[model samples]
Target chain A: MTDFKNLDISTAKECLLKKEFSSLELTEFFIDRIKKSNLNCFITNTFENAIEMAKESDKKISRNREIRDLEGIPIGMKDLFCTKGVRTTAGSKILENFVPFYESTVSNNLISDGAVILGKTNMDEFAMGSANTTSFFGNVINPLKSSEENTKDLVPGGSSGGSASSVAANLCMAATGSDTGGSIRQPASFCGLVGLKPTYGRCSRFGMIAFASSLDQAGPITKTVKDAALMLQSMSSYDEKDSTSSRKPIPQYLDFLNFDIRGKKIGLPTEYKVEGLNSDIVKVWDDTINLFKKNGAEIVNISLPHTSFALPTYYIIAPAEASANLARYDGVKYGFRENSDDLEDMYELTRAKGFGDEVKRRLMIGTYVLSAGYYDAYYLKALKVRQLISDDFKSAFEKCDVILTPTTPNVAFPIGEKQNDPIEMYLNDVLTVPASLAGLPAISVTAGKNSNNLPIGMQVIGRPFDEISILAAGKLIEEYRSFL
Target chain B: MSIDNKTVRKVSKLAKIRINEQEEKKLIEELNNILGWVDELKKVDTEKIEPMLSVFNESMVMRRDEVFSETSDELVLKNAPESKSGFFVVPKVVE
Candidate 1:
């Protein structure tokens, strides 16, 4: 029997095909585990639907029919993705009772491929936070034990925190996470999992709740690089619904595994060594470079000079876009409604009460930046700086095939550590945002654990539509992720 | 760039959200803390770089010259907080 504790997708597929276990049996195991879980990882549970779907898949296996890519795999969908007839909260009270009448393209794709929908996982309210603390459903507790003594409840890094926690805890085979900045990779790092954020337009943004449309893209968080490849193969497709989606055909992602490093150029940027990075993380970062060099990769010292400005520039642009996107959530259309006799008062009351503190803070920041007289100095200036940040990657890619860095400056901290200070919370994404601004494909691989046995992740960033290169590098790093 | 209560109020008004006085006082400090980021962003020279709004650099997607939604108003209004006679019920807009 395969171990239920770490049931990765690759093994699950093999186990099902070999008749070692039925999909119904596997789905029941996950459902039972989720029922006993205390992690607060899911916002809504859908066991009945999952069981029904699993039964249908069993028939196909019994008849020896050609199986689909994600056939019968029970995975968690981050609440940000709209599921038809299922509640999608985007982790906010505003959407507490809102159920989508239609499915998101990615969720539609996942279902079309015969994947069972487990339930919606919790996330940051409107995907605005670095920690899961901002979730209206409450914080998701990291399953990994904090190496530090007296740290009882460590936070799963987020807005993909719940998705990461579920996968890491083995409550599900794998899960989906939407990365606006470091949402997917950070939480994956914190939980000792593999997470990938495909190039900005690789996955369609149609059904995913918009945080910052330009920056948001969904990807798979899993136990192995191969699992992420299998999930991405199903999630990614060109759609007319999302204009930014690329027409570039997705290569069979698994084909890129065992990516040869014999002649690959790995770029190491000096700027990622920012102030206040955890020394343990730096050690892991250095070790990753050495591992690459030993594998016959030519290492190049490159510079992404505009890297420091990426966080602030992201702060400006993302909030500006968020404020605009979230405007549709006023009392009338759907979701929660605050009763007010006056029309204007109803909009204000519903929004004020429905949104959390962090969401309001971002909306305020967004409104302030885009208001009259501040447009050129803040909003437009941010756009120009964004271009410079994007250009830095263009030039860096000209010299190298991939770039490597630490996913987070530190391992997962106990929840409530940075909750009060928004700037500190914002600083968590400093390393990951530059790649987002450039629309490059980046993946985080669990390299090793720190003194507290908390996980540390190494990031591999690839050029535009070049997910294969990073997946290849990630697979290599996964093999022998030596750390001090 | 430390924001005052007046500007915070104005911005909140623009965003159409309400805030209490205590929340207002805390927002001032929080917004000021974030100003440091913008201050750093100002140091960079991006005078010649063109502003980028979209990343794919693709032209606008020509919408299919066909009707998208036809006879689906009932389904669209399924989640509305209040609706009547095939239209969303809203409070009086004009005095």
Candidate 2:
């Protein structure tokens, strides 16, 4: 029996190329693992389809055809991406049974690259919450239980919680995740995985269910930075279907993972060392700075003065966009519909029943902000502030090649700890949101483990479309810590 | 900038999401809590700054007006909650 858990994507590809194990055997290994695991990582398992695809991949390999980057790799996709003929829930009842006739550009790109689809992973409803607790399918339990607090169930952080958990638990080689305000990075931090949210528009958003369209960008949650690079290469493509899709050339990111950080300017934002930051995470940040320094990288103290406004700006802008994007889900074309006597009643009832509390709260906040009287006061002001926030990063990037910070304020907390308090929950995205706001590529890599043996992650923020730099920096840390 | 139950109800109506008396009470507290926190944005001096419409700072990529691929009507209606004769079935909008 192959010890698939010990292998990363690169080594697995090498094994596949050398005929150590067939794609069918590898797919069955993961399918069996998924059946045995209790992570609740997947909302839907496309086992039969995956097996069929893996069989086809074996035939192509035997025929001596050119293999694609992700060929024969069994991977989980966040439920946000619409999979043709498979349920794409976005972890909401509104799309609970919604099977798309079309595939998302990202998923289609993955499929075209010869990747075998494992299933749809669970996430926050419409990718709203910071904790995965808001998912309609139920909360994904973090496999990393605190050694000290063994009684409590640790949460695999939000929105991309399932993606992070599955990759961490070895259920699949890697999985896709959509990050809007730290969904990818925070969960990656909590679950001890590599999560990369590529520059906005680096990956097309053709059929991914819109959360906050402007902020939402799909990337990968993988066990290693190199796997993230490979998954992202397969996931990104320019499509006319999404207007925001970048026409820029996608680089062979794995080629840039040499970890030679000589003379690389790494900026440490002083504002990130705020009062409430856990001291352990601060120590990890300090240790990371030293690690980079030992690698001959210059660590300069920088200030993004507008950092305080990021969460507020994100809350206002994200919900405003979400209200607009989600307006189409009035039980008209797909998903759940509530019975009512009148059109207006049906629309209201269906939405009320379909959406959960966090989603509803955001929609209400969105509607209120975009409403006539409050438009200029709330939405417009928030957008202008967003400009300042983005400008701060632009100015900071001019001075430094990359910015480093703790991925989250603290390590993974127990599942139900912060779900009730919205503001407490929103605080999880504070460090991760600035990059999303600027449409810059940011990656979270495991830095160290905390006192309780829970994983902690450090984020590397790069310039717009400069994913290679951040990936290289991430690779340095990934190697320095020997995380892989 | 404080949100009240009345404001929550009005916004919920505008959003076309039904909030009951209990939910409205809860929403009022939650919305107020969030809005209170969001009020910090008002402190920032954003004078003369243009509202960012998008991060790309690029014009929408438009294609020439031509039919590219023919999507079957059945494919479009595949996920509909209710449909009949290649049309979505919904509560009467007009009369």
Candidate 3:
């Protein structure tokens, strides 16, 4: 049996095609890994369901299959994406028993492409927290060790922590992740993998549990950049299901994987050189720049002067949107509906008990900001600042093809470190929130390991529908660093 | 400025989240800290600047305003804490 731990999508495809392994065997291997690891990576494993899907894939493969792009690949899905019949809790008690009747577009697309659903992975409650600790199920442990002998446990960053952790641990080959602000990239960075947050509307959002709808775009978290690209190719398509899905023609992301970046103008935003940035992070970022230079990519200093407002602006806008979107779950819809003597008590009791502390905090902040008295003062003001932030990125893109920054200010902190400080937790997305506001594509690829051997990632951001150039630049950094 | 206890209770009611006396005391302190930091936005010269509502600048798209749309899915609505045949069952706002 091939070591499922070491297999990437390319090798798996080759092995399956050569009859070295059946898709059933591959699916079983990862399913077995999930069973043994007990890493809190999965909240729900459709083992029987996956085995049945694998059997069908085996039949197609044996029939000299009309090779689906992601044919026979097993992918772990973040629980936030709704899967019909299977429980999708969004890692919140409010959705604990909720099984969606319809499949999310991303999940449906994966099913159509012959990707086996390995399981539903864990996440922060309603995809709210940066640290995985907010999960109702439990925190997912970082797969990488502090050292071979010392397994000093750290949090696999979240709210897509389970997706990243499972991929890093080889629980599944590649997984689907949603990035609202820095969800995918932060977790991927922590777990040492490639996480892509596509240009807003690049992937259909239909049936994906809402969390800041305008900002949430589903993308793949994978072991290799090529695997991520291939997954994106299969996952991204214009869907009538999602009204906001971009009508822009899909580009062959993998076709440009080997493209030359000889004359590429990479923009480095000076505003990211703010105070409190870890010196070690800066070192890795500087090294990544040097590697780009060695590969003939020119680097240019760019300014996104309004970047300082991104965090506050995001807090206001995302919560404002989330507050509105999440209102659907007000004890009057599917999921946990508490029974009380009176109707008012039922509405008050259900939500109060269903949502966790962080979700409640966000809801309160959202409601407070969007209330009639506060809308103009809080939400509107933040929206204007958001525009300024987007404008800053747009103007910078005019100067360069892609902008680069540290994906997270520091490497993943210990699990409980930031749990109590909401502001500190919110600040974790400082380097990432700006891109989301602009509806641009951004990714975090592992640049290098820190002193503790935890991975540090640097982000490459591109203009709308310019995912190719971002991936190209990412691959360049990956290839260039492989030599060093 | 420190948020008063009564204001904290009022905001809590506005937010639809219940806070006990002890929790309210804690929330009051936390809200003050957050408000102090958020006060920085007031420093910006947004005097003549227009406030942004949404990202896309689309004006009202005309459609058939008289068209009837389903208020709620029966199965979904039935899952609520309290629901009538085709509507959400909520407390009577007025007699």
**Among all candidates shown, the one with the greatest DockQ:** 2
Rank all candidate structures by their DockQ, best first, as comma-separated numbers. 2, 1, 3
All models, DockQ values?
A: 0.78, 0.83, 0.36
- Ten contiguous residues minimizing lDDT sum, candidate 3 chain A: A475-484
Q: How close to the true structure is residue A192 of candidate 3, measured as C-alpha lDDT?
A: 90
Q: Candidate 3 local accuracy as lDDT?
A: 0.83
lDDT of 1 at A342: 92
Task: Report the CAPRI category for model 2.
Answer: high
Clashing pairs in 3: none
Model 1's lDDT to the true fold? Answer: 0.90
* Stronger candidate by lDDT (2 vs 3): 2
**Which DockQ value does candidate 1 get?**
0.78
Ranked candidates, highest lDDT first: 2, 1, 3
Model 2 residue runs over 4 Å out of place are: A482-484, B93-95
Q: By TM-score, how accurate is candidate 1? A: 0.98
Candidate 2, B1-95: lDDT as tens digits: 78887788789889999989999989999998998999999899888999997898667766879988746889888889999999999987776
Query: Which residue pairs clash within candidate 2?
Result: none
What is the C-alpha lDDT profile of model 1 across A1-484, one tens digit per residue? Answer: 3447777788888888887888898888889889999999999999999999998888888787968878889999999999988999999999999898888999999988878888999999999898899988999999888756676798899999999999999889889999988999999999999999999888999989999999999999999999999999999999998998888888999988656877899999999999989998988888888888888999999999999899999999999999999999998989899988898899999999999999999999999899998888899999999999998999998999999999998888888898778888888999999998888899999987777788899999998888889899998889897533
lDDT of 2 by residue, A402-469 (tens): 99999999899988898678999999999999889888899999999888888889999999888899
